[model samples]
Target chain A: MKKVGIVTGGTTKFTKTDISIESLLVSAIKQIFDNSSNLSQKDVDVVLTSTNANNKYLANITSELSGMAPKIAHSVESLCNSGTNCIVSAYAYISSGLADVALVAGAEKTDSPGLVLDWDKSRGQYKHPIYWSSMFTSAHKRKFGTTLEDLAYVGANNHRNALDTPYAYFEKPFSVEEIMESKPLTENLRLLDCSMPCNGSAAILLASENVIKNFCEQPIWMTGIGQKAISASFTKNDDLTSMKSTILSASDAYKMSKKAAEDIDAAELHDAFSICEIIELEDLGLVPKGEGGSYVRRLYDTKDRKINPRGGLIGTGHPLGATGIAQTIEICQQLQGKAGKRQIDGAKTGLIHNMSAAATSSTVLILES
Target chain B: MNKFEQELRNGNFVCGECSKCNKLVWPPSDLCNNCFNNVKWRPISKIAKLVEFSSKNDEYFCIAEFENQIRVMGKVENILNLHVGQTLTLVKCGFDGKEIFVFGLGD
Candidate 1:
């Protein structure tokens, strides 16, 4: 298999304004062309679109709109991690000698049908994401003594980090007190603790090591990738305190990359809710189990941007399909020293964690400069 | 509607049990996940143990496990104190586009 590297990427501002999925996708794609001086319509060999909208032939449509006639074109949808899933598909194409240059684009509308997993009958009347999140919170609180204040700190820190991210949906920062005082969605959840669904798009260009120099000067190599799907049903996650999929996926990712959690200079965690970040920190081996709350609180107090520096899904606004790609882009920028305000200095390695469907499925990627 | 949804709409909670492996296939599949053999539909027990719970607008929602395998999220009623591992009875259940479960403390 050939080495695959991210060549260039672009993103559109995440917002709640009504926008066509195709339009949002094109806006992000146009940035790739604008960013890469050598990139042209004829250079793209594959076009993969990640989205949850019911639109048909989206990859072909976006390919034409972007003036590309790739040999391979299709769509990939895996709920919140669709963007990275599509990128992985492109990586496969490039690594297998099937394609050299692949363009991956992801977009989501505010009212995307992907928000709710209607197929999980186990969720029953409590099908909304908050219910599962609440369950995770409740269990974490019961077992680890995680408190509402700890949950609030996750929100406040992420929102504070988002203040520096231009493309993030949230512009203003919220105090811990403000987040704690927000409208209660459940006994363990608050409105501020949740990630808002919004309209957004992100795109990335990938190239094998052979032709990467043509598209980018300092390409970020995709060193490790791991994905796991235990079950689609929410009830399958018996251990509510931790995300089983995330733990398993991260283990594989670390093993594949030959790097431990300490080597990861920064990471973009899938904080769909506050409890998610706390659990992911432990599950990913970045922190000890049951110590995630204190770790995050310490990060918050010290103004550290080591985790979710670009603002995680909670602060960045979850566009579902576009989120993973946006996260990958942030890591790429951080590694390249292009991330202005939120850049973790001298970061040589980065990680991306994206999950879907109540933590039943997860994808972890390790990237290096 | 499949057997599970059909039975649920009729106020019956049923799960797919494999005849060969005797393993309960959750989410109601046509084939057993363990043996790939055909499954038989049967009613699930109403006695469930609380797994986790949280309240929304004064209405309690929780995950209840039955038969030590099948688990689901539903509404809890007539119980002031909720704790994990507490036994509860499935008082009423129905499927109205979405599955609805009402659990109460056992008398």
Candidate 2:
């Protein structure tokens, strides 16, 4: 694959703001230009928007708002992983020689529709994600003897990490005791165990290797990329404890990058739920199967592994469409040594894992400084 | 209502059996997920084993595995000292005018 690099990136605060999706996209786009040295809106060759908002012409609308007239413009939607999907699409456009520079922006409102669990009729009243997440938690506990304390550590650790992240929604760190005693949203999931929905936007400027010379001085190269989709309904999946999509997508990415799990110095995983981060850790090969709880406990005890240095979705707030893009930007900042107080020292390689809809689809990207 | 919901309304638990691979398909699909062949609906045994379960607002919801490797999600009634891998049997189908399958502890 042709080498593509992220020239510049930007993100809005992940909070419950009353900003329209259009304004949010424009803000994120302007931030990218403001951060870059020589990049301009007119230099863009393609513009892609990742959103679930009702706006149909988001691609065109973003261009008009940002004052850009790109050759290609469109929107990409795949639930929470929409942001990563847009980046992957932009990567393709740059690699295929179809475009020299691509701008991928993702924005979502807190009240965006279509997030409800009404697609499956068999679920009836039990269609909500809380039920599915509860099932995963119970199954993991039954299989691995994972306790509630282990899950609480994940929530607390991510929350603490978010204290230093400027764009994080929940900056107040909660102790493990507080997380365990928080209000229960489901059988085993507490209020702190779930990622809150909020309004946010993220933008990334991808440039081909040739364009990087003139556009960016220090670009973060996107080394490997992989994506996969599985069954949307939870019942169709074979194992309730692990997501097959993550496993397969991570494998593809590892093969492309010629790097193993141990080679990655930092990672930004989708922690839509506390258990999700643990399960993704195992499925992505960062930790052995059935050892995710222990791994998280170690991170909590020592603060060594730089997982979710930007506080993950739990601490950063899950803005659905913008989440994957925000995660990618976090990894980029980590690799660039620009992550302020949360920076993981000597971080050269990083990974981003984003998934959607009960882990039915996923995208994995490997980035190197 | 769909065929699966209609079947539940008539007090029958039916699943699509792949005509080619004989794999049981859940969520009532038109084509076999494994072989991409046509599917034929057939009645399945009411007996199932509890795979996993959780409670919310004192109501228990569970995933149960039946014959032909078919797994279904529904509400469980008469929730006693329930545990994973316990035997469960379909007690009734549809609740509150919706196709909500209900199961109970099996003897």
Candidate 3:
């Protein structure tokens, strides 16, 4: 198989503003054309749109709006991780020589139907994500003695980091005390611990090694990709203290990339909720098991930008389908030395973790400059 | 509604057990996940062990496992010093656009 690389990417500001999904996707795609010096509609051989919206023929619609007619066009829907799923499809097309250049765009509306997994009857009346997150929190606390303060630090740090992220939904940071006092969604979860569903879109241009330099002066290589789905039902996740899918996917990603967690200079974790970050830190091998709380405490205490530098889902706003693509864009920018204030100094490699439906499924990507 | 919903609607918690492999199919599917064989429906045990729980506005909800395989989230009643691995009896269950499972500890 041939090599694939990310040539350029663009994202619209995440907000609660009402916008058409088609328009949101086009807005982000337009940025790719505006930013890339030599990229044109004709150069794109594949167009894949990712969103939870019920709209039909979205990829074709996006391509028409963006003035592109590609050999391959379709949509990818896997709930929260749809963005990366779309990018992965594009990577497959480029690497397999089916296509040399691919355009991947993802977007979501604030009221997108992807928020709830209604089909998972195992969830019963507790279908909303918070219920599942609460269970995870309760178990993690029981297993690791993770305090509410540790959860609060995850929120506080991400919100603080968002202040420097221009496209993030939150403009202000909340103190740890304030986050602790934020409206209680459950006994173990607070309103601030959850990510806000908002309107946003992100687009990325992928090309084979042969043509990547034509679109980007500094290309970020997609070295490794890993994805796993344990089950669609949330209850099938037997281990609440950790995301099993994340662990398995991260292991595969590390093996494929020939790199360990230590090689990840910067990372964008799937902090859909506060406890999620703590668990993901441990499950991804970034920190020792049962030590995620302390590791995050250290990151917060030292104001480190190594994790979720783009503010993660909690502070950046989660637009579901757009989330994974946006996360990949953050790491790309980090590796490209263009993340500005959120940049980790001298970052040469980065990781992006995205999951769907209560961590029942996950996708991990390892990228290098 | 499918067989699962219909059963819950009638206040009977039934699950599909594979006829070929004797595997219990959860979330109530007609086809067994293990062997792809037809399944027979049977009432699940009312007694369940608590997996985990949390409260919303003083109202507790929890995950309950039955037969060591089936698990579902439901509202907990008669909560008196509840803890994980503790057993609770399913007092009531139903379906009204949403599956509802109610577990109780005491009369």
Candidate 4:
């Protein structure tokens, strides 16, 4: 297999507002290329792009960009997983020798006002597995005795994590007590737990060994990659509390990397909701099931492990298409031991896991120094 | 809230029950998640619990937990910071001259 290395990466801020996703994406790409001496717009072998926007202008903007070679310029959409899956496809291209270097980028300007994007019709049809399994969350709340306050722990933890992150949209610190006393949405979920739409783009350079030699001397290696996508129907699965896709994807990545969950130093999981991060920790086997909550509690009480040190989507923002790539950028920083204020401290191996809405499609990646 | 056009109103807000695998899903899906086969749509009890949650108010926007079934969580609603064991149900009401179903304290 060809060796793949992430030469450099970047992320925009996490905030609440509307912005042109296409423009933000272009600017993000430009920033990455501008920062790198080895990478010009010319070195980008192919461009893997993801977004949730339906703007007509975005298509035009992409077509005019640099480095997207003719016939190689492709777009991949797994809705929210687009950002992360872009990294997966880019690695595949470089490792398979199809390309020497690739630019996997995700960007969304969901904060752009009056953008009436709708996918709820698909939810009724169960078109995606996440909505398939997760939408029931509404009715599930009705059947079970669980309260929305239980979900507050997740939001409170994420907000606290954001307090240390400069790029985080909400910089205030929150506690579980504060979160529980807040407000409610859909019973068990809170506004703080849900990710606000953001206006930003994240781009990463995936290069082969040869390409890395031309880029930077100290590039982070793309250590392992794995993905799985089944329909969103939770009825077909044996378990209801966790994600089959998340478990399977992480397992595949671990197997490919010859690493175990314990070997990872830090991580970033999709936190579309605060509970999402808590459950994903267990689903990815970072902690035992039912133990994830306790683990998060301890992490908050003591501040160890530093999961989602970048504030995740809940504290930062979730711009759909930009989320996966943004997480990758965060992972690269951790693996390089350069997260600055949010550094994982001696982190050598890092992991990233993401989903496409309500846990339908999921991707897991392993990166190392 | 004249949401007469809302799809959840026209349909039962389906869930899935796979006899083949004996698994259950809410807002039902087409295939059995376990058996990977076609499943039957089952009407849910609609009354769920609030197992997990968070709360926040960022000036103009707001969020809090309500309740749901096992593991995964539902959306945020216009309530207060609820305890871990609060009970609730999906309720239909009129808000600002609009008819809608919102999660509220259950009896």
Candidate 5:
């Protein structure tokens, strides 16, 4: 119950054209300078980092450019929720008076060590439970009518949204038919069904009312955050598609934010597949169950509330660990009224909900400017 | 395999955890959604339901119910046109683990 919250420090520049997970992060810190109007990187106290790539070397990279190294620099591994997790962890530290000025950053270069490296080979965050393979999904496909196209619809739609995002990976638009015709990775899930692998980084600086006044002018407020975990037995689950993680996470986020699902004006959902978003809409309560996909189609057909708005993972890119933080960046951008062309009109409140392990791990955050 | 026996034995079940929300999950953690904390390590259950199923040459798993709220989605367990509620066990589970579950069609 500590008075823990984040300030909207700034948003910097990044583009896949020459995207460096490290550089993006460096630029993000530079933003503290650009928007703070007076603060210097030397004014920061500590640093927190998150990523899901073989590039565990980023810690050295972030500190290199910022000039002054922090007292503590570490990495978090939460698949997609690392950003929010970093923020939450920072909130805990700040609220406790552990650090006055903290910088939270996330970035990943999925372009290296291709994602094909499965869980069994992982050392730190690499060890995965059984059923982490495409074989399991493939097995289901052999028995069901499910096809890769079902997954591609999400990628195509996400990419369509990415067309508007300058930082997105595949900014070019794609059609459902093109995605369907693309290469297959696993059963039902095509290469397109999966999130695009790319390189990018995002960073946010947090300050107490004391330190922040000297550095930030328009600090993006960290309004509410929550996290949860479930037992990790896939077969023991009652429903494969029903996300207990999402509902449970939202349960905490909604309670903390004092808001309902209906109140969220915009969202940045981790759409690893076309269906991921469809199911997420229902899981997040933005849409009714079963009808989620239909609503996606409806929205796409009309080109209205393009969910990813910034072109989702399908369009922008899915740098594993980076996606979650990037999603937060998008949410922060939306709430701060700086999303420009892709901005959700009058977006006073927003959320970034990402899932991992086929909807097992979830993270939800409610943001306000 | 006998009904209860297959439900108890047979093998080949998937397990996972919902790190996002702390829900006891069956299909392991490629994703944990509790406030979207990111996927993490947790105990996953090899247990599940056949709920109500059907037979077909094609594989599929789907179920849409209005029991409590709105529940829909299914799967095709490989080559089997598994009857509704057919208990299944994993012959192979993950990189090094497995368990069993009830598909749940009591016939």
Candidate 6:
């Protein structure tokens, strides 16, 4: 397979706004060009957009506004993991010689579907993801003796980490006591345990190895990528405590990259909820099974692990389609030692984990500098 | 209303049974999830075990498992200290005419 590398990335501030998705995409694209003097709109061979907005023809619209007529232009939608899936698609396109330079951008409004709990035909009135997360947390508590305090630590750590993240939505740190005392969205999940839904956009530029030599001085290589869709319905899942999609996808990525969980130096995981960070760590083999809570506590106490140096979705605000792209950008930044205050020392290899819809679908990517 | 919704309105909990592989399908689909064969609707066991439950603002929700590998999500009629593996019986099933399936549980 032809090798693909990330040339540069750009992100919009994560917050609630009335800006149109098109404008967000344009802005993100403009940021990419502004950051890299080597790249221009005319050099882009493909453009892909991912969003859950009601707008149509996003790819064509973005291309037109950005003043590029690329051979491939389309939109991708896979709920929250749409951004990662778009990158995966672009990677495939470049590896298959379909394009030399590809641009992938994701944007989502605060009111995107699946962000809010709504009355659904099949799942009844309790269709919010909190119900599913609550079940997972409760089951984890019963199986592993994970305490409410453990969950609180997860939220507190992410909030504290966000203090240094420039684009994070909530920069102020909340103590563990404050997180535990926050209003309960469910029996086990409190207001602080959940990630806020906001508006945002992020973009990444991918170039083939041949194209990178001409314009890029530093490139983060996309070594391995794995994506899996387990089950759309929560009831169809075999286990509630673990995300099988993450396990399967991460395994595929690790196998392709010829690396184990220990080889990764830093990571950007989809912490849509506090419990998700814990569960994903275990599922990705970063920590042993049923030790996610303990692992998080250790990270919090020692400040050693560079997990979610960008504060993840919980602190950065979850904008659905833009979230996974932002995760990729964070990992890229870390691998390049450009994450500023939150940068992990001596970071060489990194991983990104993003999932959607009750952990039914997942995308895992391994990057190396 | 569709057949599945009609059955639920009649106070019956039914799921699809695969004609080829004999696997049970929940949430009522036209094709079996395992074999992709035409599915036939059949009444499932009224008895189930609570797998997990949560309450918010005095509203209780539960995930219950039944025979033939069917798990249904529903509301608990009586609020109680529920535990995993607790036995529950299906009290009623119906649609609220707004396309939401309401599954009522009993002790």
Best by DockQ: 1
User: Which portions of model 5 show Cα errors greater than 4 Å?
Assistant: A1-24, A54-61, A111-153, B1-80, B87-107
- Write the residue-wise lDDT of candidate 5 on B19-107 in tens digits: 55655322233554444444444322333334433222343333322212212233334544555445443223222222212222322
Taking all chains together, the TM-score of candidate 5 against the true structure is: 0.72
Please, what are the lDDT tens digits per residue for candidate 6 over residues A28-107? 99988988887778889999999988799999999999999999999999888999999999999999998999999999
Two-chain complex of model 1, DockQ on C-alpha atoms against the true structure? 0.93
Interface DockQ per candidate: 0.93, 0.55, 0.88, 0.07, 0.06, 0.54
Interface RMSD of each: 0.5, 1.8, 0.6, 9.8, 12.0, 2.5
Cα error, candidate 5, residue A11 (Å): 8.0
What lDDT score goes with residue B93 in model 2? 74
CA error at residue A339 for candidate 6, angstroms: 0.9
Docking class of 3: high
lDDT of 3 by residue, A1-369 (tens): 988999889999999889999999999999999999788899999999999999999999999988999999999999999999999999999999999999999999999999999999888899999999999999999999999999999999999999998999999999999999999999999999999999999999999999888888899999989999999999999989989999899999999989999999999999999999999999999999999999888999999989999899999999999999999999999999999988899999899999999999999999999
Q: For residue B69, what is the lDDT in candidate 4? A: 32
Candidate 2 runs further than 4 Å off: A122-124, B9-12, B17-23, B32-40, B95-99
Q: lDDT tens digits, residues A1-369, model 4?
A: 899998887766655556666666777777677768866666667777777665653433564765354336767767778877878888888888988888766777754321221333322222322333233333334434334454566677677777776667787877777777665553344456577776777877788998697877778987878798865433333344677788889999999999999998989888887667766888888987666656776777687646888878777777788888888888888877777878888899999998865665689999989
lDDT of 2 at A74: 99
Q: Tell how far residue A347 is off in model 2, in angstroms.
A: 0.5
Ranking by DockQ: 1, 3, 2, 6, 4, 5
| lDDT at position A284, candidate 2 | 90
lDDT of 2 by residue, B1-107 (tens): 55666787788878788999988887687788888998988988999988888888888999888883777789999879899889999888763554577899797
Shift of residue A97 alpha carbon in model 6, Å: 0.8
Residue A89 of model 4: what lDDT? 83
